[model samples]
Target: MLDCKPASTPIEANHRIKADMGDPVDKGQYQRLVGRLIYLSHTRPDIAYAVSIVSRYMHDPRSTHLNAAYRILRYLKGCPGKGILFSNSRHLSIECYTDADWAGCLDDRRSTSGYGIFVGGNLVSWRSKKQSVVARSTAEAELRSMVSGICELVWLRLLLTELQLYKGG
Candidate 1:
């Protein structure tokens, strides 16, 4: 989509994408495109959430899903310079921020949880995934996200210690 018009955002905000909404599209093509986007998300955190959403319908992709995937491609074309930046800060501290929405998915009423881990004031790790269980309340959804974030933080701490880069709690 080099010559295609660029999209301002990767995905439309608050747009509910149902699995069985649009007509069926070529499964192989959609999967291959999303697979490439998944790899690209490793370096472009801006498209992580969008890529995750499109990756969900890889098994039985519809036209709606394909359009969303194209929007991500358009977004990438618009902002080619966007990427992660890791600076060498004098002080090394780990900070994780997480958030979740209650019943964000209309199809299954599953809340989506996301977290971004910053090390030395630069984003190092991040993830956006739907919770396995259906949370009855917003508080419950948020709690689940917090637990996931803490788990990642703990893992990162252990890794830093192993590499001799961490000295304090």
Candidate 2:
């Protein structure tokens, strides 16, 4: 997709991946592309959700998946230097933001829970994953996401305590 038109965004917010849509394509190439995207997502959180969506089709990809992969490539080419930026900021604080979509998955009707954690104003941890349990209501989905974030917060708190790095009460 070197000559393809560039996309401003990696993935469209309204686009959803469907397992049973489109014609089947080569699995090997699709998996390889997804693998590279996954690796890229490490520092480019902007593409994390998009990469996660495309990665789900590695087992059996189709034309639509291939097109999405190409779109990501175009996005990457548009801004090769696009990634997280961290500096030596003295301001330190443990913060996390979380959100969930009620039955967002087109295939399973599963909700997607996403979170981002920052330590000292630097992004340290983030996730865009589908929930294991099927939530019956929007409130339930939101609570499930909150629970996940709380678990991560508790773990980080314990870790900070063990390291004697934080003294917050």
Q: Write down the TM-score of every candidate.
A: 0.96, 0.94
Per-residue lDDT for 107-161 in model 1, tens only? 7999999999998999999999999999999999999999999999999999999
Q: What is the lDDT of every predicted structure here?
A: 0.93, 0.87
TM-score of predicted structure 1: 0.96
- Can you give the lDDT of residue 153 in candidate 2? 82
Give model 2's TM-score versus the native structure.
0.94
Off by over 4 Å in 1: none
Q: Which pairs, if any, clash in model 2?
A: none
